[model samples]
Target chain A: MNNLVEIVNLTKKYGSNVAVNNLTVSLPKGKIIGLLGPNGSGKTTLIKMLNGLLTPTEGTIMIDGNYVGPATKSKVAYLPDRTYLTMNQTIREILDYFQDFYADFSRERAEEMLKSLGIDPSVKMRTLSKGTKEKVQLILVMSRDASLYILDEPIAGVDPAARDYILRTIINNYNPEATVLISTHLIEDVEQVLDEVIFMRYGQLVLYTSVDNIREEKGKSVDAYFREVFAC
Target chain B: MLGKLMKYEWKNTWKAGMLMLLGIFIVTVAGCIVLQMPGGVVSNLVDGNEANAAQTWLVISSFTATLILYVIMLLASTWGMLIFLGIRFYRSMYTDEGYLSHTLPVTANQLFLSKVLVSGVWYLFIMIGIGISIVALLVSLMMGLMDISELSGVLTQYNGNVWEFLGDGIYELNRVYEEQMGMNLLHYGITLLLTYVAGPFITMITLFGALTIGQLSSKHKGLIGILAYAGLTILSSIIGSTVQSVFMFSTNIVSSAGGTGITTNWAYDINVLTSALVAAIMYGVSYYIMNRKLNLD
Candidate 1:
């Protein structure tokens, strides 16, 4: 259970172009881990495999000691990079849906977050601004008392101020015993809050170490080092 | 979980269906009523004056236009319902909305069954709506041609024993048709009804299976899905025709080269069996794609 996510030799290919190569890694519990990578580096692909969105071409992903099935899905809260909700449905309906399916979903927590943002639960998703919709999606994801939170580009769509609020929500609201796996290209903004970083390059793991170690041992911030290594 | 999925599935799909059904009811009633107007006008033609003739022509022209519109509305809405359901499945299970649906704590079978069952139920409701509309149309047409008293007497003769009345009605119908042919009309009707009810389920499976196949493509997935569906339908029709021809040639069911061809019920039964088997296979294929071969971008 300490290793919340165990991906073993996972590979996802589209016709012969490998998206996620034979990548294997173990993520520990109770830490905010930044899955940092450049564009097309397979960060979202790997996150998708863990959330059961894409079936891996090979290998396995075990979350909370369960294979990526319904049992594992109940423990993983996934926020995809796009708006996955229907435009016609009200936020209240989606909340009911989540509460019905995921035992870990908390309606009160989600409602509280919505109230804080001055968003009416009765408002249809179509009526919300893109940034507000992303915030709502983040709210729904963070409201779940899940064992693993897999968020893909969670802050990419929001404004700078809302990004800070969303980052705070992610850092403060998640289960202390759970792990949060965030995939994003904006490493500098997230490096401060990350307990650890898993830097990926070309669908291969480049580094997996603590943020303190990156700053202390490498004598550079994660942002400064990332810019140096991934500079085009 | 399947029930919960179906609840939302029903909610998401029912609004357009309700509106379509209401439109069908309104159009059928109004069309039938207006169709009675031309007959009423003719019956009241006293001396065929110039104004009366012009009015009659106007009425006839309007009636013809209304008839065309009614037919078009019925046919378009029926086809529209199927297309809407297919789009629903594609959007919720294949497009951006799939991110929410796939990540839920539910199995692939649950998702597939929810869409199939909901779409099937909608088809059944629509068939019933169409059936009721047809009955209304026939009743109005009959009323226009016959006296109200005569129609009331006919209704009274049945004494509200609907089962007996239906039985007698079918018996009379077959007794008349049996003079020239020797096929069971009830059996043929039952087969048709089965196809009417079950056809949409097969179509639903084909659509979902095709969309699932569309996932294999890098782009133009929805269009590719439509092409796949067209391919499946063409393939099914070929299979249906082949099976039908085989039954015809093997059994030698025709009376003569042109007299009373296909009088037996074997062809309809085989058609149902073929559709059922194809749907089962496609259902299995769609489930497999959703389960293992899913490649959402």
Candidate 2:
């Protein structure tokens, strides 16, 4: 299988401190990969660089065989860690905006998801709770038929039940030919849904292997292996 | 793509912009109505020379209040457009919303051009709206101040078209200025018009540049942006004044040394050229920062 994302000598520095230091990794297509790391382990920075929000200080990120720019942006669906939607806009307006901007976005799928979630399309974003807002953002990202989905902390800072809904939405909505890169620290919650895992520790990728391989080799859940590897 | 971007930009800013415009219209209309009634009474009393002190005071106060309201509305209509557009740019491009804005499938140049075009259109709209409101207010005041006989006489003298009367008045003034100061008032009028139209574009782009500079720093960015703008303004003003003085001095020396045919229109030409030059520099700097050094935090 060809890789959907390739990072070559990627090093992002703030001033003196390196956020992502000379990291190299490639993510194959058509799998849900969990990017597991603790806080400040450079997960978000890597995702931002892939999405072209932050220019790489040292190297290049290729998405779907194209360098990160407007072309790559069209193929990558990104869900940032925060609520980036305008507070005054309604759910319907945001969906319309996504549909207008992203040619791969499916308004029908978004509406169906909103209906399944029992979310009011006319409700303003500011009136929604933080968890609901996060869910809305996830639904929008998942409705896109892009080549890659890069979601940053999609399951963090929400209730366990909301987290389950988000995971289910991701599982149901992603296309079979596309890849989804989800960044989060809740390994146990996401392990069952992920086919592969990539672990980063202190701005370096420490592990990248299939979940089945890890389970077969270690005789334990991927979460247990994560706990063992990241233990201080 | 630029059109679509501007459509959404208009969607986000139209509420505030329209409300400000509506406020100007309402204030102008209300002032005109109040002035028409009170102004007639006050002028009639004064013309008859029969009003007591109390009545005079009441008329004066009423007229003054209406005048103040008209002035305030006029000022608000003009300044509010620029302020509102600037706020829209800052909020949409720099705040948390920037995450989506920058990630959209559009290049930075397209985004910048869309914003500049939208802002420019809205500025022109506000200027024209204000111009119409002022004309309406003046017409009302004229109607209120003139007695029936004087109004008829003036109406007949101007062939019943106030615009023609105003045009003739301007023509006379232009001729007087031409005779006295060797300045073609028509040329001055054209220069002023061009400057007025170009000034807002330059100002908006300069603000964008300062905002971009401020974004380079992570702390106290707003204050830094304001200070940067102030510094730019002061530096440009000093340079402009120095150039103007040098031009003036040289022109005076040459004219006194017997260059009679050479007109002082060079001064205004240079003035307009200098403004266009500054605007171009500001636009270039703004485009550079937006395209290359966009630090949207």
Candidate 3:
């Protein structure tokens, strides 16, 4: 399989404190990878670096064969942890903005998804509940036919039903050839969908292996292993 | 892309812009009415005489208009800056909303360019609005619809050549308008577009500088951002003042060498261009910072 994302000796620092410490990881195409970590474990930092949101203190990251810059950014879809939509904009307006900027944006899928959720595209984003806003954001992100979808805590702030809907949206709308890197602490919920897992701790990657490998080798679920690895 | 970006920026700030424009309109109308009021009515009500009523009204109206104009200008610019820098940057980075912004498959340069374009458009609109209000007042006065002699007197006191100044000002205005009009309505529209772009360009720099400092600081992210902004402002101001002082001193030297006074046409034009160049440089610095070191994470 072709490597979709390659990070070489990546290091990100906030003053004297290192956020991502000399990390080297490469994600293969067509896989759902869980970037698991506790708070302040550098998952967000690493994810940010991959998306070209943050400049690495050292080393390089390549998206496909291209260096992570303007060219690569065009191919990557990012869903940040917090709601990024302006409060005043309706769902339809946001979608229109997306269509304006991204040629790959699937307006049909977005409208259909919103329709299924009983979300009127004309309703302002600020009027929605937190979970609904997340859904709106998810719909927007997933509607794009991007090469890679980097979702930072996609299900972090929602109820159970919303989480399921968000997961289903990801599954339903995801392009088969693309990669999905979802960062979340809800290990069990995402474990079934995630083909591989990368566990991070204290700004370092503690373990990176296939979910199948963990299940087959340890005869234990990813949740059990996560508890063991990140147990305080 | 820039067009779209500007459209949205304008949309977002439309409420504030509209409010400012409305306020200007109301003030202009009120001024006209006040200026048109019979001298005797105002004088009898206030001081019991119609004498010097036009002058009184003009002074009051001009002062009021100037104040209103300044406030509206400041508010419009502030709104533009806030939307261009504060809301847009926050949403583009550091928030879940950035998913839409960063994932749009557009280059950062496109994003930045769009913001600058929107800001430029709005700023131009603001200047035009002010100009229109002034012209409305002038037209009303010219039609003998209002007592504008008082206002004219106040203007003369400031420069002692109201008619000449008005003529020169109108000529300059026409020249700018004609230059823009030559490009069709599209080009004329883009004049404001380019001007508005400068606001966001400056804003991006301030934001980048603030974020850089925020990342470096151990605590007080907001406070640190403020300090960073202040530092940048101070640095720019000091540089500007120093350059102005140098130019003034040098111009004085030249004037002395030519055995003339410090006032000269060449010196004035040079000063204006120098300031414009400085503003351009400041904007360039801002663009560079945002382009090179935007820390969305």
Candidate 4:
């Protein structure tokens, strides 16, 4: 399988502390990958670098064959951990903005997703509950036909029902030709859908292997291995 | 893409801009009303001497209008531009709100360019609006709705040497009108818009410099960003002042000779050009920093 993302000697530092240290990894196309890490394991940083939000300090990250730039950024759909939408905007307005900016954005898909969740597109973002806002953000991100979808803690703050909805949206809306990189500590909920798992510990990649390979080799699931690898 | 970005920027800022424009309009109207009250049929209806009322009202109205427009234009333009640019920039960076901004497939250059263009266009619009309003008031007075005869008589008296007698009279009149309306309408407006147009470019540079310094700092990221901005500001100020002083000194030398010669107010032109050059430098520095070392993350 062709690699969709290639990170070579990618290192990122915040002051004296290193967030991602000399990490080298290649993710295959059209697969769901779980980036599992502890509280300070650099999962967010790694994901950010992939989306061109943060520049790597020591190396390069390429999306498909091209390097990170405007072209690569256009092809990547990012859902941040927190709500990114302005509080004053309505869901419909936000969707319009998205449609205007991103040619790949699907307004119909976004509207359908929001309706399914009982979200009123006309209501201001500030009026929505946190879980609802997250779902809305997720729906918007997933509605795009992007080459890569980088979701950071997509289900972190939501209720179980909303979490399931978010997961279902991701699974159903993502294009088959695209890859999904989900960064979260809620490993068990996402373990079943992941084709590969990358375990990070203290700004370093401890393991990068497929779920099938790990389960077959060690008779353990990714969540089980996460506990073992990140055990204090 | 630029068009879309500009459209959103305009839409987001339209409310504030309209409020400001309304304020300017009110001040202008008040000044015109005051000017017309003195010499027109209204004065005759009042219990005052028609001639004296006419004279007093014209002077007062003219002064008030000029002052009000100046003040309102200044405040409205500055506040409007600042709020618009500041909010957009703040949202575009340093917040999760930037996910949409950064993911738009537009470069940092395009983003900056869009902001600059919008600011420039808005500022231009404001200038035109103020100019047209002032001219309209003057036209109304000339058409006999206001007792502007005294003012016109004064100008006509110096018609042979209008430019010299005026000695910035037109500008002064406009200023007074703006002031009376409780606004610095034009000065502040122009300054604000110019600042808005130039601010982002400066900020982009500051951000780049700050991020670089932050990376090098032993302190926290936030602290480093602050320190970097401060450092860059201080550095730029020093350089700017030094350049200004050098130019002023050189100009003084040239004008010292012209002081004894018959060369008019050439120094004023030089001063304006020098200020414009400094602003251009700031703009260039901003673009350079953003293009060269922008760390989006």
Candidate 2 residue-wise lDDT, A1-232, digit = tens: 4999999999888778788999999999999999988888899989888887776778888888888878998999999988899999999999889989999999999999899889999999999999999999999999999899999989989999999999999998898899999998888899999999999978898999999999999998998998999887
Output the better candidate (2/3) by TM-score.
2
The deviation in Å at residue B42 for candidate 2 is 5.0
Better of 1 and 4 by lDDT: 1
Give per-residue CA lDDT, model 4, range A1-232, as digits (tens). 4999989998988768899999998988999999898998999888877776676778998897888877887889999887778889888999999998888999999998888878899999999888888888898899999999999998897778877877888899999999999999899988888999888887888988899998999899888888887778
Q: What lDDT, from 0 to 1, does candidate 2 have?
A: 0.82
The sequence of per-residue lDDT tens digits that candidate 3 reaches over residues B1-297 is 666766776687667656666766776776565444554444343454454666666656664775576566556655654545455544454455554555455566666566555644554566566677777766754444434587677677658776777777767875664453222333334444544445444545455445445534446654676677677667656765666567667756765586443233333334334434544664455455445554664
lDDT of each: 0.85, 0.82, 0.71, 0.72
The CAPRI class of candidate 4 is medium
At residue A114, give the lDDT of candidate 2. Answer: 91
Q: Alpha carbon lDDT of residue B83, candidate 4?
A: 48
- List, residue by residue over B78-191, the lDDT tens digit for candidate 2: 777777787778777877788898889998778877887778767767777777787888887777777779867987988899999889989999778666555678787787
Least accurate 10 contiguous residues by lDDT in model 3 chain A: A47-56
**Which numbered prediction scores highest in lDDT against the true structure?**
1
Which prediction has the highest DockQ against the true structure? Answer: 1
Worst 10 residues of 3 chain B by lDDT: B180-189
User: Would you give me the overall lDDT of model 3?
Assistant: 0.71
What value does DockQ give for candidate 4? Answer: 0.59
TM-score computed on alpha carbons, candidate 3: 0.78
Q: Where's the lowest-lDDT run of ten residues in candidate 2 chain B?
A: B258-267
